[model samples]
Target: MTLGEKICRLRKARGLSQGDLADTLGVSRQSVSKWETDSSVPDLDKLVALSRRFGVTLDELVCGEGDAEKEHEPEPLPAAQPQGRQVLGGVLLAVGLLGLLLFTLLWGLEGLLLGLMFLLPFLLCGVLCLKVRRRLGLWCAWAVYLPQQVYWTMATGITWRLVLTTPHFTREMNYFRLFIGWVMLAALVALTVATARSFSGLRKEPTPKMVGVTAVLWAAALLIWRLRALFFGLFADETGLIQLPGLVTGLLQGACAAGQTAALAAAITLTLALLRGRQKQTPG
Candidate 1:
């Protein structure tokens, strides 16, 4: 292959457009285009930069003597082995459907509602088992988990008034539920990290900017969660005391859960970016 062909192939392999490559090389897209078309050649300094960017030696880049064409040939991707995950996904889907049917028959509308709430996560889990790329499935699954209390109240025909006024809604029960919420939050973070690492491309170190963004997102989320009491104060009664209605609190709590999930997602993204950056810096 000619030098221009080599540059073209290398740029494509890195998933860069002429504009992107130009930005990195501190040159115009036209320059890169000209280089790729052999209408012009990069100077020695630019050549060195190109070699470094593509992780190729100067000799190999210029002389095309390193079996460059053969080395850069696209390899066939292995076929997916879907038997195990597909079977697991199918089983979970069946269980969710079965539960929906059973509950609808036994408890009528209320049971159906409850079953549907429960079914969402199981169905998503099944999708996750089938296709790892469906990260939104995991998010949907977790979203259902976040509003469990709201769903419980609705299913049991319990009013917000009863929850607030009744003595049975003890502080201890609230604490227990808070603890569970934290546990779920931790699980979400862990799952997000695991999912990011599972993808081969995300296993590299991240850039400093990415790390900063992650830190900022986490800090913002924590700040918001900590200021929940202040926010509740906004909905206070005439006495200037915080007095949240049950449904409002439930909605706020669900929003908090979603925010926490988003923060964890940002953290996962930073982790992957950091890994990619580290890999780039490391010697092969």
Candidate 2:
């Protein structure tokens, strides 16, 4: 291939637009366009910058030598085969049916309601994992699932308040709860790291937009958590209704949980999109 073709290929392989490449190279977009069209070649200094940016040697970039095609082609994404899809569908269907049966047998209406509440996030995670089709997807699935499960468990009466206040609670049970909480927290941290690594591999850098969004989200979550009682009291008094604090607290908790879940999900999706975009750039 000509130098222009090689530059074009490398630029596309990195999932960068001409403007993006130009910005990185500290050149005008027209200069990049000229280079790709063979209208003008990069100066020696610009060539060095290009080589470094694309992780190629100066020899490879200037001489049009080496595995330029292979290096420029992105890794292929793993596609879900027909058999795999069928098996996955069957498993999901069976699990849903079994869950329904169990709910019917156990607590009837209340069980069904609780089961739906608990299952929604898991179902969403499963769908996202299938759509992402990457190791990062599995990590994100757990990230979404763990917090939702913890919230549901706590909502079912194993709250921190109860654990802290109840003297009759068994020491063993408290330890068990603490262990579970720690495990969930550790899993979340691990998943976050894994997701960041995967994103870096695909995009070669962490996205400032996503980092900013995540920070905003977590800040909001922490703020909400800290001022939860204040919000509850405000809403309770505004309604002029008795026994409304519990309702307000529940609503606020759900909203905060939802905000937190959305933040994590958005971060995960952004990373997955980066990987997917790189994979899609691979030649068929």
TM-score, every prediction: 0.46, 0.50
- Give per-residue CA lDDT, model 1, range 210-247, as digits (tens): 57777788786567656765787788889976576554
Stretches of model 2 off by over 4 angstroms after superposition: 1-86, 97-109, 136-140, 150-153, 156-173, 202-215, 235-258, 261-284
lDDT of residue 41 for candidate 2:
86
Best by lDDT: 1
- The regions of model 1 sitting more than 4 angstroms off are 1-80, 101-113, 133-216, 226-234, 239-248, 268-284
lDDT by candidate, in order shown? 0.65, 0.60
